[model samples]
Target: MDVKETAAYLNVSVSWLYKNAVQSGLVIYRFGTGVNSKIRFNFSEVEAWVKQQRVMGG
Candidate 1:
């Protein structure tokens, strides 16, 4: 997903993803070069990470 899609999927602000997605190990994929690069996310990986972040058993 793209930044906006990802932000919506994760229910977070786009800026938060820009600031923290990499650090949180979300497996960011960058397209193109420089600061204008477009970023995408792995849906399954993101789901896994979200599961991993759980503090209690479901």
Candidate 2:
């Protein structure tokens, strides 16, 4: 899904998703280039990562 869609689905701000998820390499994907660059995420991946984070007390 798109960045906005992912952020909405995760109930988080777009900026938060970009910073914490994308930049941190926690739960995001990048495609295209420059202004065309897109951000997407897999819901399952996000869920699993969250679960791992919880297990790790992060």
TM-score of each: 0.87, 0.68
Best by TM-score: 1
What do the candidate models score in CA lDDT, each in turn? 0.90, 0.75
Could you tally the backbone clashes for each prediction? 0, 0
In model 2, residue pairs whose N, Cα or C atoms come closer than 3 Å (at least 3 residues apart or on different chains), thus clashing, are none
- In candidate 2, where is summed lDDT lowest over 10 consecutive residues? 49-58
Please give, for residues 1-58, the per-residue lDDT of candidate 1 as tens digits: 7889989988999999999998988999999999888899988888898889889857
Report the alpha-carbon TM-score of model 1 versus the true structure: 0.87
Clashes of 1: 0
